[model samples]
Target chain A: MAPTILILALGCAYNEELPEKDILGTVIVPAAAATRLQADGTTATDPRFIGPIFLGAYSGIDTVSFGYPHPSMGPIVTADTPGDAFPYGGTTVGRYDFACYESLACKVVTGRFSDYNDMLEYFGTVLGSPIQDDNGADVANGSTFQQACYDYFYATSDQEMAFLGDLDFALNADGDFEAAFVMPHTVFVEGMTIWGWMDAPEIVPANPTESGGFSSCDVSTGREFDQYDENFREGRVYFDALNTPSQYIYAGDWVASGAEEAVVNSPDDKPVVRLDFGFGVGEAE
Target chain B: MRTHGNLALGALLALSGLASGCTNVRDGFRPVLTDAPFVYDIGELRVIGAEELAGVDPSTVPDAVHYGQLGAGENAGLYGGATFQFRATGSSVCVVVDPEAMFWNKEISTQSNTVQYKFEDIFEDDGDLDLSAGLAAYYTGSPGSEIGDFSAVYDDPAGVEHELAFNECIQTGYFGDPAHAGRATVEYCDIDTSLHSGVMYTAVLETFALPIDDSILNFGALAFDGRCADLPWYDSNGALLAGASECVIPNEVEYADANGIPEEKAWFPELERAYCSGVGKVNTFCKDNPGAGCQSEEEL
Candidate 1:
């Protein structure tokens, strides 16, 4: 009834439109080999080759414990942008856009990450969660409960150094650097769950990128599980929780004992690793 | 008299095990190779929810039964039933079917509503030497009559300790299969369900998550290596769950028992499918319940 109120109401009813179009791009890397060929022509010898970059929107779903399909965070996406065909590392999984919301909506969806960049970023986030519980780490697989690391990801910081693409295990018979073979696996970052493969550089390399990612990933001198046992045992080895809760994080998937064994997949190909994962990312030596 | 009795028992078992065999995973043992896709074994089953499903409520039962008994990390949706997976860790739980319980040999009376049946009449005894007491296959008298009476303890993220007790008889058998020993799968099926999961999922991530033709239900089974005779069924006691039976030479995979019966290894057959009273109730919810919209397994 008031003129100011009526004018405000009329203004509120106005709608704005913007022109937008969906963009498409493809990463070409045919000829399946140990080395992942990227569309940028830069071979992804690291685990980041597996795409589906997950940008964390929230801290985590605060459930008392972590279970399958752990509570979802908001605005999650498996693609680089909405509806773009992301590059796939393993070649077995396809591309898709995933938006899982913890509130009112949660999906136990499964897919492989198409790029390694997203995965490295994710690892950085996990290595950085304050107050991670012990059971929150890999349990049921026979590793005892440790107090400091709490979970498997941080407990084995030195070993995960390889997962970050710092260590290179894939090699040829001649002892030359072979292309790194990666396997997509299900990982839990705080509450959001995604299917990403673990990859670490077998060789120590000069660090690069915004935060330069992780240093443990560089194992150029060759790695021996024996060396990292104490580091992993002591939880304080790899990731640092010294950062803020938002920056802190822990993440990784269980190495498949059998093809059908890993919650990741059930394939007839009964290998030491489940079909969802691959061999050289560094299995329990 | 006791010495003579023991000697006689030994002689019988010697004659009983005249032959031994091996299992060929390719020939038949693979659960998927079966004609019907009953996700789990039907014989050694435990009926979980009494009509109200009050026993399995996560709120009341803080202790959780693991889902990877069959498949690892993943929940292999059984044909008889699917899973109740949590959105959090992908952890899942399924209907708690008693491993010792079997089907009713003879037709029993059905209550008019059909949804709820008298538990007493539903279970019948298998004609095995061990299952003697009339209706012996099932625990005496009531559902909780056979006191498995075991407790499982867990500590939460907050360092808060939690303990869960067995409501029914349960005994763990020694499975010679690799179990992938250090791995996390039950080497068979893991279908989980929960009240809070929001979705009643039935996807056999490791095996076959395909749909079946009709309604799905849980069944019992006697899963042995199929090499020796079936594991002698017994009431749930420390001896049974702990694999401490005379018929079961827990020490050796191949050995003879006191009864001259080769302590042949036995187990709940790989999880298969079966029809139970619960099917009716589940279907009722699927049909009337808008969210559940129960469909034939084929539709899953």
Candidate 2:
């Protein structure tokens, strides 16, 4: 039998028994030691790799032209890499994780961090923040000029703080990240563990300035190509496939390299896709 | 606090009107009334520091008007230009020429490192006192964001869009006034739970003259051959009222902190109402009723 896959949610209380509002949920399935019935009713053995199975979907994705500057990876993409623009067709482009697909509906694991700061720092590291822009300038210069700029940009008379706090509360507490991840339904890992988790794919374009014929390109900085195209983003399906019993999938990508044959290896492989169906914002699930 | 300062600034502006008529005599300068009834053609204004707009549809705008970048700001993108026309249809009534077409641009970045910002081209950054009051009100209230869909409320000719749903009316009030002078403001929004961050309260008043004869209402606009340039939005009180405004125009940003939660509908009303009336017009009905134009503190 497949190891029972459980879906866990993050960012809320577990005891209150509230409807999962965060819009993100996780599931656990059979690992190397088990097998789950696929949609086709065939049972397949779990595949093992150095990193989590979730990361396999986002491997080798690029990050430049997605908004923030691309991180430094040897022989990969970066901002101002002598390219016209990222082929995604926007001033900014990048990838992020959306973990609420129907495929992630097996066993669940759950965990929580101490506070918002811990979550932000951990998420930033995992999502890749403090990355140098094309000019090698990160946001944390802490220079007098930068501080002065920040001061003027955020003038004293403006009500920017209140509005911002409202946004933070919405994204953190009311956004419902917790309910989907708590208990046996989800898995809880330390913030450091998430930061140290394997990276997402780096998706580069065959051409830099122009659209690369394909609907999207997944960037390795863990930034998927869906954000640029409205249609692709709407159609995104995020799934977590568990291989090892105690493992969580962090990053993966659709690859032209040997991944296709690997995905179709077994008769019982039920591929999972995690879909973030716009929680409390747009297009609700 | 903003009220007293605004009153003082209003008095100063009234004084400037005495000497404004005699200065900068132009051939086109006709005898303009204290409250001139004329259609102010809103020129092309651009959004600053924006590279892309998420939800705004460019094709929604009609092709009759020629859109230009107003030659200002850095990398403002296609969603940059906003044009609005305000005409005094009656004695003191300024109805938006095209209410449906009236649009403002807003940008909000969830990343703390990248502070979200929106800018309106309303002449000088802080040349006249009215400009400052007008700008502060705009940022704090009018522009609203539904999750990532940032929109500027076009109800007021001088207002900026605010993302807060609960206190939308408060924003309309704070930035609704077009009379105060000499202020330009930018907001660095800290996403903290406190109403007052480490930085709080900014007040400045620079007086400018408005003639009582046939001419533009604002002297600064007259100097530039009629244009206010880029204006800002929001102020201290207005920010508090965003929760109040959200009662009417519900947005995704407002739903983040759902109702019944301690943080829901929480705000300073004294500041909200006082600031709304002092700066903005007297709501939808007051503008409809001629005698009800300006409301005193007690009457409101």
What's the TM-score of every candidate structure?
0.19, 0.18
DockQ of 2: 0.01
Q: Which ten residues in a row have the lowest lDDT in candidate 1 chain A?
A: A100-109
Q: Report the TM-score for the A-chain of model 1.
A: 0.18
> What i-RMS does each candidate reach, in Å?
14.6, 21.4
Winning candidate number (lDDT): 1
CAPRI level of candidate 2: incorrect
Each prediction's RMSD to truth: 27.7, 26.4
lDDT (Cα atoms) of all candidates against the true structure: 0.23, 0.21
Clashes of 2: 148
Give the TM-score comparing model 2 with the true structure, all chains together: 0.18
